[model samples]
Target: MSSVPITKHGAGLLKEELQRLKTKERPAVINAIAEARAHGDLSENADYDAAKERQGFIEGRIADLEGKLGAALIIDPTTLDADGRVVFAATVDLEDLESGEKVTYQIVGTDEADIKHAKVSVTSPIARAIIGKAAGDVVEVQAPSGGREYEILEVRYV
Candidate 1:
């Protein structure tokens, strides 16, 4: 797969999770499986079955995280030199043209996106529409409720 854009903080979070999984969760799961196997009967052992399932999930997640981290292109927003235009990791303040409501969002990767935290995925409609745009630019976004207009009010690298 192609390298995905990820903020420095996002990359750090992934690395921390990977470390925890490898150093803590992986060992715990292995111990659980071994203990379950020591219970004698493997045919009707729910504990053994459950432990094996958990082990599968843990291993799969570890591999997935490793792949993502390997293909990540980490960037620090503070070091960006976009000259005021919208780009990945840019925190933007926007005004709804129709409702006159204001909102802020940071363009981030899919793995780091949290709507409650105001972090939007780079592939999201709003992010796509505002990318390469500067303050005072109006953008039309295709929303489920229909097309909506938003005016860019401010942009911050952080």
Candidate 2:
């Protein structure tokens, strides 16, 4: 499997979730399953079935998180020095050429992509178009609406 690119913050969040699942959720589900098993016939026990299903989901998520953490390549944006070029973990200020609206986005890993938080995935169309660009450069992005042009105003590491 290829290494997964993630910011330091994103990696930390994943690790924290993994820990919570293992230590807290895992134990709670185990106890729930045990209690459900005490409810008599296993065949018709709805609580047992639900607990087993929940356990499966939790265990699957735990495995997925472990695999991702093992393959993660965490990058700290504050430590990067790519001159003025836009790169992964770069926070870019842009001006929409058509609407004249200014917005900022931080290029992050897919797991951390949250448009509401101004974080975009590195694989996203807009991020791809601006990856190697510097300040004052105009980039054309193939957005869902259509082809849109944005002028780079500034690039910051954090």
Candidate 3:
């Protein structure tokens, strides 16, 4: 399997989730299933069914996190030396050409993309348009709303 690129922070978050699922969620679900089984007929027990379903979801999530972490190529944004160009994990400031609004975004892996937190996936249109470009460069993004133009104002590793 190919290695997936992930920011160091993103990898850490995934690791924490994996640990929680294994140590807390998995054991809790197991106990719930056992307690439900003790209550009586597994064929008609709603508690048993719900516990089993929850167990499946937890196990699936654990496997998915493990696979992703095993193949992750974690990159620390602070250690990057991309000559001021926007790259994975680089936080960038931009000015909207039409609206004249300024915004900041950190380009990150798909799993870490949270617009509410100002993080964008590397594959996103805005990130794609800005990657490899430096400050003062204008790039047009094909957004769902319409094509939007943005001028790169600054790029920071942190």
Candidate 4:
């Protein structure tokens, strides 16, 4: 599989989640399954069925996380030498040309993108438009509503 880019922080979070799943959740579910099995007839046991379903979901998530970590190319933003240009994992400050509103976003991988936290996926329109662009550059992004322009005010690698 191709190597997927992930911020160092993002990779650490994923690793923490994997550890929790293995050490805590996985064991808890196993115990729950065992308790449900001891309840008697497996055919009519709703607890058993529910436990099995939960176990399936947990296992699937574990596999998915493992695959992602295995293919991850962790990049530390602080170590990036992009010279003030907008690149993967760089936090960029921008101003909306039309509304005069300002916003900041950190370009991250899809798995770490969270709009509520101002983290955007690299594949997002704005991130794509600003990639490799330095501060003071004007970028036009094609949004679902309409095309919008933003002026890059600053780029930070932290």
Candidate 5:
């Protein structure tokens, strides 16, 4: 499989979730399943059905997380030496030319993108447009509504 890029912080979060699922959630669901099985009458056991469904979901998630971790290329933004160009895991400040609004975004992998936190997926239009662009560069992004322009203000590794 190809290596998937994930920020160091994002990798940490994934590891935490994997640990919780294995240590806490997995065991809890196993116990619940056992308790439901003890009730007997599998055909009519609602608890057994629910517990099984949850177990399936938990197992699937565990597999997914494991795969991601295995193929992950964890990048620490602070250690990036990409000069002033915007790249994955780089935090960038930009000014909207039309609206005159200033905003900041950290370019991250798809799984780690959180709009509320101003972290954008590298595949996002704005991020793609600005990638490899240095400060003071003007980029035009094709948005769903229309094309929009932004001026790159600053790029930081940290």
Candidate 6:
């Protein structure tokens, strides 16, 4: 499998979730299953069935997170020296050519992409168009609403 690019913060969050799942959720589900089993008849035990289902979900999530962590290529934005060009993990400040609206976005991994936080995936249209561009360059993005133009105002490594 190809390496999955992830920001340092995203990798830390994944690791923390993996730890919580293994140490807390896994053990709690096991205990719940055991207690439900001790309640007697297994045929009409709704609690046992529910606990088992929850255990399945938790185990599945743990496996998924582990796989992602194993394949992750954590990159610290601060360590990169791309000069003024936009790159993965770079925070870019942009101004809309039409509306004059200014916004900032950090190009991150797909798993960490959150528009509410101004973090965009590296594979996103805007990111793809802006990558390798320097400040003062104008980029055209293929948005769902049609083509949009943005001027790169600044590039930040943090």
Q: Model 6 lDDT vs. the true structure? A: 0.97
Clashing pairs in 3: none
Report the Cα lDDT for candidate 2.
0.96
Candidate 5, residues 1-158, lDDT tens digits: the string is 99999999999999999999999999999999999999999999999999999999999999999999999999999999998999999999999999999999999999999999999999999999999999999999998889999999999999
**Model 4: per-residue Cα lDDT over 1-158, one tens digit each:** 99999999999999999999999999999999999999989999999999899999999999999999999999999999998889999999999999999999999999999999999999999999999999999999998889999999999999
RMSD of every candidate to native, in Å, equals 0.7, 0.6, 0.6, 0.5, 0.5, 0.8
Q: Model 1: residues >4 Å from true position, as ranges?
A: none
Candidate 5 lowest-lDDT run of ten: 78-87
Q: For each candidate, what TM-score against the reference?
A: 0.98, 0.98, 0.98, 0.99, 0.99, 0.97
Model 1 TM-score (2 dp): 0.98
> How many clashes in candidate 3?
0
Tens-digit per-residue lDDT, 51-141, candidate 1 = 8998898899999999999999998999999999999999999999999999999999999999999999999999999999999999999
Kindly list the per-residue Cα lDDT of model 6 for residues 1-158, writing each as its tens digit. Answer: 88999999999999999999999999999999999999999889999999999999999999999999999999999999998899899999999999999999999999999999999999999999999999999999998889999999999999
Which 10-residue window of candidate 2 scores lowest in summed lDDT? 139-148
Candidate 6 clashes between residue pairs 3 or more apart in a chain or in different chains: none
Clashes of each: 0, 0, 0, 0, 0, 0
* Candidate 5 Cα outliers beyond 4 Å, as residue runs: none
Compared with the true structure, what per-residue lDDT tens digits does model 3 show for residues 42-109?
A: 99999999999999999999999999999999999999999999999999999999999999999999
Q: Higher TM-score: candidate 5 or 6?
A: 5
